[model samples]
Target: MGSMAFSKGDRVVWNTPQGRTEGTVVERRTSDFQLDGQKFTASEEEPAYVVESASSSKRAAHKESTLTRRS
Candidate 1:
């Protein structure tokens, strides 16, 4: 995904095991990271977004291609 950058506090939606979920973008992760003992792969060319769930407040990392910025 090129030129798709999301800033912190941005509202976004993504698909999850429970179906579509809404959340706020916590940050952009260009480097690999581990959260809650789960490893996430990321790169500048294909960055991942760390987001906080709106309903549960749970945090998870998702690829940019998987996220849609909410208006």
Candidate 2:
């Protein structure tokens, strides 16, 4: 796959304009999809993740490379 080894409910962190943010992995999207009116490209080799922000509970889709597994 595309190194998106995280499973659903896994705690993860990623960088954002506001700085590092933490959240839980809600789903792994392997096909192209739209979220929040934004397009996201994904594939079996380069998957995208639907993550729910721990602080705001806002959901956003992000490429696997942008996410880091957290404890």
| lDDT of every predicted structure (CA atoms) | 0.91, 0.91
Question: Global CA lDDT of candidate 1, please?
Answer: 0.91
* C-alpha TM-score for every candidate: 0.91, 0.92
lDDT of 1 by residue, 1-71 (tens): 47678889999999998899999999889898999999999988888889999999999998888899887
The predictions' CA RMSDs to the true structure, in order, are 1.1, 1.4
Stretches > 4 Å off in candidate 1: none
lDDT of 2 at 9: 96
Cα displacement (Å) at residue 38, model 1 = 0.9
Q: Which clashing pairs does model 2 show?
A: none
Tens digits of per-residue lDDT for model 2 on 1-71? 33458889999999999999999999999999999899999888888999999999999998888899896
